[model samples]
Every structure is written in C-alpha cells, then in structure tokens.
Target: MRVPRSAAVWMACCMALALAGCGADKVEASGTTDENGACVLTIGTLGPLAGPAADFGLSMKGTADLAAAEVNQQGGLRVGERTCHVRVSAYDTGYTSAGAANGAGEFIGQGIRFVIGPMGATEVTGMKPLAGRNDMLLVANGFGRDALQPQYPLVFHVAPGPSVWAAPIIAEARKHFSFNKVTIVATSDQSGSDIADVNEIRFTQAGLPVSRESYQRGTQDFAPIVSRILGHDPDLVDLASTPAADAGTMVKQLRQAGYTGTFCRLGGESTAEIARVAGGNDVLGNFFYYSMVDLSDPRMQHLSAEYEQIAGRPATSLTLGWLPAARALLRAISAAGTTTDTQAVAARLRQDPLEDPDLGRGVWTGQQEFGVDQEMSFPFYMGYIRDGQPQPLVRLEATQP
Candidate 1:
C-alpha cells in the first residue's frame, strides 16, 4: 500500500483519525472531532470507488459508514476501561491492484492501523506487502479462499469462500433446476477462476452435464460467450462472477439472446446503481445468489436497524458484513487495549475471537469461521431472486460443514 501524494480529503481525514489515536488513547475523549487530544481510530476500506466495480465499493462505503456511526452512538467502544468512538475511512482503489496498493499506502502513511477492505481478493492480495510493512489489521469483505491461505496473516475474511457456495448451489440445481446440460459465465480473473473452474467436476458429480466460458473481469460484451453457451443449450446458467458493471451487462445480453431460462448467480454485491444500469428489473427473475442475511437471527437485528437509520439506505449484505467486522475489530482492540500496536490487535483478532451479540447465547472466535473456531459468528445463507428481491434461501450457518 504505497501512499500517493494525491490522496483525497476522505483519505486524509481517516489518516488524521489514526494519527489522533481515535479516542482510544486520548487525554479525554469528548466524542467530537474538536475535542482536545481525543483519540481517533481510523478504519479504512480499500475497494473501487468510481470505476467498473464502483457499485460494490459504494455498498462497502455505505455499510462502513453506518458501522462507524453506530459505534460512535453506542457511546463508543470499551477498550478495557476507556471508550473510543470508531471512525471509518474510505479509499477508492478503482478496482485495480496498483490503485488498491496506493490506497493502502496512503492509509499507512497517515498511521491508519486498521482497514475494512481491499474487498476484492485480488486487491487484498496486492495490499499484503503494504499492510505487512505498516502492521495493519485488515478485514476483507470479498472471497475468502484467496485471502485465507496460511501466509496472509494481517487479513480476516468474513465472507464465505467459493467452496461454501459450490455445494449448496449444486444441491439447489438438483432440486429446482433439472438439467442434462448447463452453461457457465465467469470473470477471467484468478478469484473468478478459482470459483468457476470447477463447474464441470461439480456438475457432473451431481449427475448433470456442464460447459463453461469466462471473460475478462471488466469485459461487458457477453454476446459471443452467450452465443456459444446458448448454442450448447444449457438447462440452466451459472454466473460464477462478482457484481461489477460487466456482470449487469452480461445479464442484459443473455436476456436479449432469448435465453429465458433459470439463472443462478453465486455470492453477492448489490446497489441501486446496478439496478438502475440494468434498466427496469430485467435481470431480476430467476437470479440465485448467496449473501449475508441474519436479519432474523436476533444477533444482527439491532445493528441492522442502527445501520438503516444512519445511512438512510436499506440494509443489505454490505451493512450486514461491515457491522460484524467493526464489532469483531473493536473486540480485538478491547482485548489488546492499545491503539498504536497493529500486530497486537492482529494477535487479539486471531486468538481472542469475539462472540456474536446478535445470537445472544453463542460465542464465536475470529479464527473459527475464518480459520479460527467460531461457527455462531460467521454463517452463510442462500437466496434466489423472485419478483426483483433476493429472498433468503438458507439459514445463516458457518462456511464449512
């Protein structure tokens, strides 16, 4: 995460929060920016802001912002005996590795010790060196397998990886979508391939035939790929890709191709912008996807309401994942009891695992769901789009069996 000179005011403000210790080690935390010597804790997000995948970044930004506000209003986080208000800092990486690295650098330059994203797995991978250099604790909001490897110690992924969805989606395929054949469309990126490349094996094992094709992550034209897939005439279509401008565009082309069949999209990223670009609920029907939906889980209801109030936007996957990440990190801070030590916080996150307040009786550790031991904290759900809404398809459960 190399720092660039042109960092925006949003980046600068977050840096300032980190420098000021985020009311964690303040002389006296008055809970206002003007308060003298108040500690300020900066949580940074490294996702695209205004490029192809800007919608995901925007969703991340909104949820992160909501988390910050909720933490502040709850009278701040309790670190040992002191309380420090949480503040979120956002940086737009523009969906490129270099851009993500630059944002990470800027946050590190300004003393930001904690980050919420670099959400895309590739972006997170690129920022590893920088986060290591600055000793930052990163909570990634994207695919997990890429970040959950043994070596990447600074980051914790709250989202379930591909394996979680592969089996479940396959099961759904058996139940609802009968097939002798299927066509798959995925982005031509490492993470996408990691998830998409397995369609043949998984599909055949489930007693269904499958064919696949992939395009570059930012490629919008799906005409050729659609033609080829439709030529084979798949019983159902699998979109094993992330939500970006390309994803929405690809769906439109498929719809126009007169391929009105079952469409199931794994994982999640949603926004008003995407809905608008898709133009009138065209891509809504038969869209199956996975996302965080603990709304009725008692544990998440409070935070969900708090987010809806603060951001003035409907609560979705972004808010659901972001709030938990905030609480998880805050718990780490409380356990470690220091604002300046990134490594110490990382250790706390790894070793101290926090219990989910959303599920009143169960305790979860940071390592459990991610790599640790908490099942009650991190759970995955399945859903399908019907009448333009993603209704929950499975109860929230841990990533692995």
Candidate 2:
C-alpha cells in the first residue's frame, strides 16, 4: 500500500531534520535559543509512519506533537529560569529494529534528551541500548514481557501490557458474553507472541480453554490462519496484539467463513479503524476491545477538541492514549529544571503524581510484572459492539501496583 500523502510529507520533514547533525558526537545544547534568548527543547518521537502499524505510530507522533504545541501555546515549558519551547522531531521507524536503532542514533546526534515512542517490541529492543548509553529517556510503548526492567531505569512504559489489565478486561467480557474456549491470533514475532502468552494465561485462569495461532508479520491474507482457528471450534477469538489492519482483515475473513463467534482484542486501541476495515459494525457483530480512554468523559472530549484545533485533523483513538505519557515527560523535565541531566529528569518523573487535567489521575505500576514501578496506570474502557451497533462503553477504574 502507498503511504498517505500527509504521512509522507511528515516523514520527509522528520528525516531531513534528524539527519542534519549526523556528524556531531558531543552532547550539544538540547535546543537552540530563540531570537528572544529563550531555550528551545527538541524531543524526538520514534515509530512507524508507514506500514501496517502506521496508525499506531502516527497517532503517537501526533499526540506528542499536540503535547508540544499545547505547551508552546501556553508560552512554553518553564525550566527553572528559562522558558523552553518544546519542538517534536519525529522519525518513521517502519516497525523495524534497524530503523528504530538508526532513528535513535540520529536523535543522539541532534542531542535529543527524550523520546515519546518506539512502540513496537522490535523497535523498543533496538532502541533501548542506544538510549541507555546516551542517557536519553523514553516514554515507550511495547507489549513484550521484558520491555521494562530495573536495569533500564531511563525507559518508562507508557501503559501496562496484558499482564496488568487482561484479567480484568477478560472478566468484564464474561459478564456479557458466554465463551467456553478461545483461539488467540497474533503475529509470530515477540511483540505478538509475548502478548498472546499473557492473554492465554488470563483466559485459562478465567476457566476458558485456549489455543494459539500466529502468522508472520506483513501477511495480508488470513484464510489459512482462519481455517486453523476454526479447527479449534473456539467460542471466542482473541486478536491479541495483532495490528489493527491485520485484525480487521481476519475479522472479515472469519465472518465470511460463517463463524458467528464473539471477538475480542486485548491489545491496542483502533476499534474504529478495525470496524472500517472489517466492512463495518455488522461484520464485527459482537465485539469487545480495550479502549485506552473513556471518550465520553468531558476531559477526554476536550483533549480531542484541542488536538483537532492544533493538528487540523481529528485525533485517532490511539492518539488520546499517548497524551498522558507525553504530558508526564514534559512535566518531569520542567520539575527537574534541566534538559541535559536525564537522571534528574527521570527521578522527577517517578516522583511526580500521574495526574492530567484531561486524563484524570493515574498510578505508577508494573512492579509485579516488570519489577519496576515505571508503567503509568490509567482508567480505561471496554467498548462493546452489539448487533452491528455501538453501545455505551463500560469504564474500568485504574489499577494499583
């Protein structure tokens, strides 16, 4: 598929900016001073801007850009004595390990101290070592079991994976749907396998027998996989960690194959896109998925409004999920009063309360899973599709560590 024109333009701009200082090895000023002599802090956003997962990457980048614009609109972030303007530098990682590592390297050359993403497991795995060596902080997104560890203190998770929220989400689904067995479909990569492993455990613990099926990344056809899944006679099909595009295609194929079972996705937020690709709500029939935000909340609505105003486009569901993390990073930088001292910034990040006027209060979790309390826990919702129409979302309270 061809890359969207808007995405292509954004990618060109970001690559040009990232490569401008490729020869610089020393840590220079995080940003250049404006004509008024105020600091300009440039933060990087790393993710795929073109590919099956581009929706996720673009959403993350857009949110980070929106966060920076919000600060700039308010006269910039106050770091001690200097008023620093936030500038976002985005790089399209193409959902590849090499692409991610290369993007991080360019950011390092440009003296970027912080990054908002590198969403894929492969991307995170590729970027972490470089980020650690450079003392660059990452508010990253990845579902791999080992995505976060105490050894990598500078890397903080944007949200918990299935290990933290899967059980509750599964239990909630059980209240409305009756499913005796489940078939989990995911990619064969670590990103897919890791999340599938977590969801398998959750489903089994909930008394549902489970089976697993995986496809290689970039597979457009789901016929063979759907055939294997139907062999299990599953009452519920869990799209665990599959990209939204792939999941939607699978949904369409499964429905065409006369499978009238319920569908659930315990991964990323892309329900609207999924529905569109699946041929609409009727094709989805009975569906449930994790919603990163309660859109009905007035504050969340305000966030979407602000994003549209600044970005000149509507925010994707996944875009809203990234705002709290981006906001947290900027707030931490402000509190630390130094863009260069990442250790101090990281310390302040952990100390600051996980509160956002638009996102409400959250908590720092992940100790039980990642052995570090660095994952931000926030209130999420379960979106339900009943008989080809959307229903009111059920809000779940935020979890504690």
Candidate 3:
C-alpha cells in the first residue's frame, strides 16, 4: 500500500523506534511545527500490512488515510489557539500477538496515544494490554467486544460487535421467514464463541430454538459440518462470526447440499466477495450480512467514488466504517484541544456523539454494555445479497442491553 501524504515520513521514525528496543519513555514529537507554528498530531495504525489479512488491513489503512486527508484538507484540526495537522503512521502487526505487541510498543514509545486499528479479533485482543498500559485510545474494528472491552478499558469497539447487532437482526429475520429453529455456524475462536453465545440468547429470546456448530480456522471441508448442521432441520442458518471466505464456502457447500434454508451472516464483510466465492448470488440471494454503512446513501456513493480513486479499488462494507471512526477520533481530539490527553478526548467522545457522514449519528458509549463508556453506538445496516450485488435492507437503530 502506498503511504498517504500524512504518513509518508513515518517509515524512518518507526525503524528508529524498533532499533531503540522499545524504551519505556515516550519518544520525541513525531512531527515538527510548520511555518504557521501548527503542531502535527501523529495518529498511528497498527494492523496487518502483509500476509493473509493484508487486504483487510490495507483497506482500513487506505480509508483512514482518506479520512486524515479530508481532515487536513479542512485546515487541519483546531486545537486551542493553534492548529494540529494530522499525520498517519502505519505499522504491521503480522496477524500475530508478538507482532501486535511490538508494533504497539513502538507506537507507545513514539508517543502515539491515538490509533485506528488492529483490525482482526486476534490483533485487537493482542494489543489491548499495551494500549491500557500506555493509556492509548484505540478505536478497534474487530469482534470479541463483549469479552475484551471489560478487560481493556481504553480499547473502544467502533464496529458492531456480534451481540450489538443481534437483537435487530433477529427481529428483522423474523419478519422475513417462518423459522422456529435456527442453527449457528461460527469459527471456533474467542470471538466466534462469544458471538454464538450472544446469538443463541437473542434467538431463544425471540422464541426460536437455536443450535450451534463450530469450525476451527482454515478448515476447508464443510460437507460434513453442513450436513451435521442440516441434520437438525433448522429453518434459518446464522453464519455467526464467520470471516468472509468461510462464510462464502459454507453458503456454497450448504446450498449444494440441497438445504434451502435462510442464511444470515452475523458478523462479516463484503457480500460481493461472498457471492463471488459462492459461485453465484443465487446461492446467497437470501443471505443477509451486517453492514456499517448504507451503500446506497448519496454520501456513501460520493465517498466510495473518492475512496476508489485513492485506493485504486472499490471499498468493501468493512472498509467504509474506518474513515468515520477516524473522523470521530480526530473530532474528539479537536474537541478536547489536545491529542495527548486521552482521558479528556475520551470524555469528549462520550459527551458529544459523532455524526458519521456515512453511518449517521452515533456515540462512544459502553456504560450499558461493558460497564465502561468506551464502545461506539451507531445505527446498524443490514445488507442483502441480490444477483451478485449487495443491496441495503434497513438501518436499524443502535440498541443497548
């Protein structure tokens, strides 16, 4: 990925921090004052820059760059009497705990108190301790929020956690189908289990009997799993907490198994990718995927075009949310008047909800959910796969338990 103008200079600084052995003390200012005497606030991105999850990380990085560029285009951020120009610095997490911790340590040493990603659940959880230890504010775009948020108070889940969207999805699903029983097929991971648990509760609460099946990551053969799940005669199959590839595979294999049942992915990205992998949209024509943005919205169309121009590819459902989260983070810093005081910025984030241009109005609040006021609450979008395309269904208001 090409580094954004805001992040063009951080390569050497990142190398220096790595070479210095990640000292405990914070490093010097990441950027110098410009001719206007404006301070430059450096926001870092710690995510997978290489390997299998590269696309996910790069998409986030690219969109965040767009957000930063947009902020900079608006005369930068106003902080007290002077302005603070924003610069983004990206570090690769390699989709490993050690890598995530190392990258986070380097960011902490370099005085990056605010960051945008550690996109997947593994990396998000891996970097949590480091974030709390350094008092960094991470607006995460991953799952496992119900478990991690209570443990890592500084990490705010900006993306819709599995449970966060369960109520609305269940209610909507009830309206479309006559299902007395549902089956959940999820990856056997912390996030998957947590999502399944939540979905089970929601489905049961909705008067639907629910059964769950778990698959280890990288498992290719879904024939048996699909058969086993279908054996229970579930009217609805919830691909809860599945990654895009896995969800696509299950959809294809399940449909081939002649199981004409309703399908809904609880937490995943890119229905187009799923449809492509599933061989046709008809396989997933009834499939509904949780979305963070309403793609049909004019603002989204404009941003999508702009993002495509900058990224050289069309943005996916997951990619769109990061820009809004970045915008919210920057706005909070501006409101707090300092990027260094994470508490003040967090307080501001709680005080004033950010009206994301794409996702609509939302706030950073976890008080009701995680016992901490950190997670972002926003409208959840439901997208349906129709003839090889993702179509917007409804924008459900954010619900709190």
* Candidate number of the best TM-score: 2
Q: Candidate 3's residue-wise lDDT over 1-401, tens digit each?
A: 43433323222322233344322223222234657776888888877776434666777777677777665665666554556778888998876557778889999888888888877666777788888888998887666645346666567666657667777877876665566788998878665776777778888888888888998866778888888988989878888767666777888988888888778877655666666678878788677767777777776777777678766888765667666577667666665656677876776555544555466677555566567766676787777654445555788887565
Candidate lDDT (C-alpha), each: 0.61, 0.82, 0.70
Those runs of model 3 whose alpha carbons end farther than 4 Å from true positions after fitting are 1-38, 49-55, 94-96, 145-151, 386-392
TM-score, candidate 2, is: 0.91
Query: Residues 355-385, candidate 1, lDDT per residue (tens digit)?
Result: 3434222234335224653222455556656
lDDT of 3: 0.70
Following a full C-alpha superposition, what root-mean-square deviation does model 1 have from the true structure?
8.2
Ten contiguous residues minimizing lDDT sum, candidate 1? 2-11
Q: Which is superior by lDDT, 1 or 3? A: 3
- TM-score list, all predictions: 0.79, 0.91, 0.83
Q: Could you list the CA RMSD of all candidates, in the order they appear?
A: 8.2, 8.1, 7.8
Estimate, for each residue in 186-281, the C-alpha lDDT of model 2 and write its tens digit.
999888988899899898888889999999999977899999999999989999889888999999999999999999999777888888889999
Give the higher-lDDT candidate: 2 or 3.
2
